[model samples]
Target chain A: MTTMDHLAEQTKLERLLQVDEGSLGFVAEQEVQATRAFRQQLSEFYYQRHQDAFHRLAGLSKLLPISASAKLAMNLLGPVLAAGIACELPKDRAAKLAGRLPTDFLAKLSLYLEPSRAGAIIAAVDEDHIVEVARHLIAQQEFITLASFVTVISESTLRRIIQQVGNDGLSLLKVGFYVEEKTALNNVVTLLSEQQRRALFLAADEHSLWPAVLSLLPYLNDTLQGEMSNLAAEGEEQARDKLVRAVAQQGDWYPLLLSWTRMSQENLESSIRLPALHEEALLRECMAQLEKHNLQQALPNFTELLTEEQQALLA
Target chain B: MSSPIETLRQEGLPEQALAYLTALPEEQQQTLAQQVLSTMQKKDERVEKALSRALDVVPAPLRRTVRKMLFS
Candidate 1:
């Protein structure tokens, strides 16, 4: 699995257990599906153990008027229990209650809400409310909660949220790294304007987020991957050097090289021209990866771009 | 006395979850196992505690009614 896959699984596990990130890093090598399955089991176990109480709260919501139920949840049950009760309530009713609750409270509740279990409830909520809660979560740095909900929201709602998120590429990068659905992330990328797309590369440079940027490249379609790689090459030489060094440090040139195949010839040449790429050790390692993955054919354009000395080293 | 790994197995943690934990250094395993157990054990405790706090906020006469609404 890629580093992002491991991080994604680790993030999900951490969120499931309400633990800090890195607390579960030991499990980074476990199969992603195993982490997912284990999280599911834990969720099911907790829900089963507390179903009666949560069901009771759901029952009470049905017994009371909608506004009163919302008050009871906010004033009494708190976000965690309220979220549990909301999961058990009818999706429409939960949506109505969500409307009555404050966006801040809803944002708090979202941290505990299981997207898979409450997908319909989340979908039933108004787009405006979802946007409001998303803003609140973003302000609070609740990217994990935001990322978890990404899979459940309508694409249109997501587009609106991304629009509101504007040019904060770093926030999107952090959330994207933890996103479980790469295709959803890819779709989100498709929605970006050229400026927004460029901001992502700039953010990667400014924030040393090349690993995240590199990990994300493999998920984009050929056109977007090429476009993104071209954009990445437009960064300063120092930034490009940082990216190449990051790849070398990661010891995983697969994502970088694979993206090179899709890049415009000029952009690929620009990327390969980085002084960092000429490092003997790094070039040899890149060649080894190319041979290991049987992808030399993927880099025909790249071969023409290499210096004579670099080509000799790679050969 | 069972090992921390065994204790986790007995605590209803799934095999897949423990499999990763089992690979850690013994000291790390003990630490992580304790952490996992604490998180798992918090479910009931947190619910009961939250319910108690909720009940404490209700008017005396309404507390019983709310309790009935919740448990009934």
Candidate 2:
């Protein structure tokens, strides 16, 4: 590599290593100085909860009542970490243990297991049990748990589970937020039909889900943006205001404008085709707002795009 | 012909074009982006300098220009 290119690569690697080390040190510091409330959260992960789960499971290893061999194994281990001890089990044995456990218990345990290992166990689970566990997780709004398990699921099963929970707006959005897989966001968006997507805003405003809606909006493709804009344009006053305010607050116009650029020609023609926009009085008011916001410079050619009658309103 | 921006609207959101311009790293945004603003005039150094002057004169937010340029 060229000396300059190598140096750039070296610097980038150094920056990445620094970030990793800094975060590790920060976590260590936090642990050392963790406060009372943090201790409460940490209490939830007591090694004993896991040890209890393992002890309870080990005591039931035989098909019949607690067997002598199983009892001895549980007695000898003294204290096994509950989280991933199951991974050391043969696949058949792990699957059998998972099959016998209550699904909610399995779901809770799944959250603490390594994702790849969890995925392996989940693959052995029956769809009926999987569905029940997923339903429970969704109801509990366990997005982190949900996200963890998605990494291991087959796509078709994932789609099935997603479709089942698709309409629970806020919970679905939370899972969308927590997903670790990079394409998981867009994949979720793609699963929604256009009508289902458009309906989110009406629900957003009514349910005060607008902030989440806004956050997720930019992640969706352009057509959805236009669809949303058109829906907003047709919506109530506060809805339109919310749209304007979001567009106003954006640091970059690219996401919204890019959506505009990809909008159907029919939709583009229609944004200005509003009879209201053409009304001189409304035009004047909007122009005044635009000017008040110091946007007059951006529309240098705006007057030319207007009818002479509309242009007169600028005066 | 309508302005390139208007034509772009007809073509549908210039998601790909903006992604290319911004070099956005997100897989979904970049993967789906396509050049929707193909009719844009090639950069003219003269126009660039003139607009640069105009920008200095009015000092408007580029966002306003982008807003009007795309949606007006």
Candidate 3:
């Protein structure tokens, strides 16, 4: 599994166990899907152990008036129990009760609600309410919660939230890092305007988020990856060195070389000429990674950019 | 030999998840399983404590009904 996958799974486990971040670092070497499966079971077990309580609280929605149920959820059940009961309630009824509650309460409840179990209710809630809750989550820097909803919320709702979340490239990158579904992430990238997309590159630079930027590159479709790479190529020479150095240090050359294969010749040359690329050790590591990934076919032009001395190292 | 996989299996961990845990080295499996066991216990205890505190504010007549509905 990729580093981002490990990070995403670790984040989910932290929430499931209510432990501090990095507490589950021991599982970092496990397969990401296996870790995800393990988390799913633990989450289900937690809810299952309390199913009777959740179901009883869900029963209140039927027994009490909608207004009273909403009040009871806020004042009596509190967010955690309210979220558990929300999962047990019928989708329409849950949406109705949610509508009657405050956005702040909904935002707090969102932290406890399992997106998988509450997907239907999330879809049923008003777009405006979801947007408002998203705003609250953004203010709280709850990107993990926000990212979990990416799978369930409609494309249009996500678009609106992205617009509201504009210019904060670090926020977008952080949320995107935790997003598990590549297609969903692609949609998010597609929704971004050219200006918004440019801001992301700048944000990565400003925050020194190159590792995340590199991790995200391979997941985007070819056209967008090439576009983003060409944009990075347009940056000052110092920025180019930073990008190349990050890839060399991380030892993930496939994404960078793949981007090289797609770049306009002018941009590719600009990228490969960075002094960082000329270092013999970095070049050797890059060639090894390229061969490991079997990407030599894509980089004939890239090879031509290197001087004979560097070319000899590859030989 | 006693193993983490066996301990987790006894706790009724789902088979699919247990398969993943079983793949780890014995030492790591032991550590991860212990963490899982402790997390479950901690979450259960925390919820029980929070519920008890939440119930303290309920009116006397309704508290009995709420307790029966949930804990019973």
Candidate 4:
């Protein structure tokens, strides 16, 4: 908006007009930055708008009597949206209203609400209602939605809910792959039974959810982070791309590198056995990425994974 | 399997271009990233040409750069 800002941008544009690959790269970079910034601003604008809408809905929920609200909700809003509206109401009032609602309605509704938004109601309502909701959500295989409450809801509540839901690893696997929140995903994984983690890796590979799971790597405990080498070392292309690319992008490769190093010599040997791992161009590119990121601390792990010829490329 | 942003994310810049947008909160950043990625997937080129023409007051090279940056 300022003259100086305009002039500076104008100068950059002139320089970017050179039309060579480097100039194209610069223009592309600047364009990407501008686009991202615009999108981010739009995202904030819309989020605030939605929050305002929800606040208004909460106010309306307070005005309507329970029977009236339920009828209007059932006929007009549908159960999940009605429950979403109810979630924003005062906890004690929401609890009373929840008690009167059909169990199936409440049960199905949990699948759609953010656990954080529903936290107060989950805590205020009787245990039976909460348990039934969790049961239905888990039974329906809405593991990601169910996992939303993992960090927000009380441990006692989570324990009771999962206990009734059964000990199968499917919930853990589904939650691990599908949950995007960094801390939340890390928590769920760290809490997993060992068997559950294995089941998770297998499910991730089977379903190609490994990319989502890879996003959680940086946030996990160091020991648990080391465990991810096996996930990365999976032979399939989807897993391989997610693995190599994630390591390339992260600031700290120590956890991942160390995981590879800790692999039994045989495991380490077999890691390069994957056809994709053998490609000189990709391996060099991965090495190039590590160098670009300037993570020299990861050298030892890199050294361990590559052949002597490959190690020389880092120089 | 490859997308421009993913390529940019992997090798071009560790700090995502989108990550710099508007300097919003983390939650909004996630939503923005998803929205931008979805929009980018649709690949609208006419918008780029329009933007380029709007900037035609600048030199030809600059005009081309604007169009290429936006659509290519």
lDDT (0 to 1) per candidate: 0.81, 0.47, 0.81, 0.52
The fraction of reference interface contacts (C-alpha pairs within 8 A across chains A and B) present in each candidate is 0.49, 0.00, 0.47, 0.02
After superposition, candidate 2 runs with Cα above 4 Å error: A1-81, A207-211, A214-237, A250-254, A266-315, B1-72
For candidate 1, write residues A49-111 as lDDT tens digits: 787888876875787789888888888788989999898899999999999999999999999
Per residue, candidate 3 scores C-alpha lDDT tens digits across A183-206 of 678888888877787778788788
- Model 1 pairs whose backbones collide: none
Total clashes for model 2 = 10
lDDT of 1 at B41: 77
- Let me know the TM-score candidate 1 reaches against the reference structure: 0.91
Interface RMSD of 4: 18.3
| Stretches of candidate 1 exceeding 4 Å from the true structure | A312-315, B1-11, B23-25, B53-72
DockQ of 1: 0.48
What TM-score does chain B alone reach in each candidate, compared with the true chain B? 0.63, 0.22, 0.81, 0.35
Instruction: For candidate 4, list the clashing residue pairs, or say none.
Output: A37-B21
Ranking by TM-score: 1, 3, 4, 2
Please tell me which model should have the higher TM-score, number 1 or number 4: 1
User: Residues A1-315, candidate 4, lDDT per residue (tens digit)?
Assistant: 112112223233222121222321222233433643443343333233344344544555565578765554555555544554665678888788878777778766665455546677777888777777777777787665566567666666766765564446456555554443447655565555556566656665566444445445656766667665664464455555555544444433433445554455555555543444455766766555456656546445555766666555444
What class would a CAPRI assessor give candidate 2's docking? incorrect
In terms of DockQ, which candidate is strongest?
1
lDDT of 2 at A33: 19
Q: How well is candidate 2 docked (DockQ)?
A: 0.01
